[model samples]
Target: MQLLRSLLADRDWSQDAVLLSRLQQALLLLRDPAASLDEATWLLVADETAHYLDFRRLRTLEAQLRGCTQDEVRYTRADWQAARTAEAALASHLRHVRFSSYAPEPVPMFRIH
Candidate 1:
């Protein structure tokens, strides 16, 4: 996630078709449920997919901004906010999964009453 974010943050990354292709390839693996990845990796993949979908939706909405009416603006903004919220949820889920992976399993204690 950090590496992809770094690449997206770089202006040159947008211009690099090869890098974009590699990213798409990686995303396919991440999105596939049969990849046999660990739970943490799957969570990261789900988070990344959420971000990717959000970005695509926002970009589509942005392209419609040129002749956007007031209502369109409101709609676009709402959609963007929704995307942000989804991304936050994905991040939170990923964190929870990773944290739980390290936690010791609870052992039940029983005694004769």
Candidate 2:
């Protein structure tokens, strides 16, 4: 998950549909370690055209993931080490991912008095 962490750490990272989707998956997995990647993918693709949604989207996502939970697996130290190694390896080949035509959500500008 170093790749996910790296993407999240980069302030310049564009919060595009793809990025947001990845974030959602990462968050879901973090919140429920028993959740499988397939479950995350399914929820993200359930509404193919919906790249952005309000917080209510979580409710929708949760509904979709309701049946996909697995019994929590305990992670051994070796498993954690392997995961870290994999993340480090993946981070090496990573490139900045961005959407070509994505227009960011508008932010209100404030002028200092």
lDDT of 2 by residue, 4-103 (tens): 4544543433366785767766656766767766674656544322422221233344445664322223323244345557667777646322333257
Residues 1-113 of candidate 1 have per-residue lDDT tens digits of: 55555445434224246645655556556567776556755565566556555655665666586576433443333456676788789999999998787678888997898
Q: Show the colliding residue pairs in model 2.
A: none
For each candidate, the alpha-carbon lDDT, in order, equals: 0.58, 0.48
**Candidate 2, which ten residues in sequence have the lowest lDDT sum?**
47-56
Candidate 2 local lDDT, residue 48: 26
- TM-score list, all predictions: 0.34, 0.27
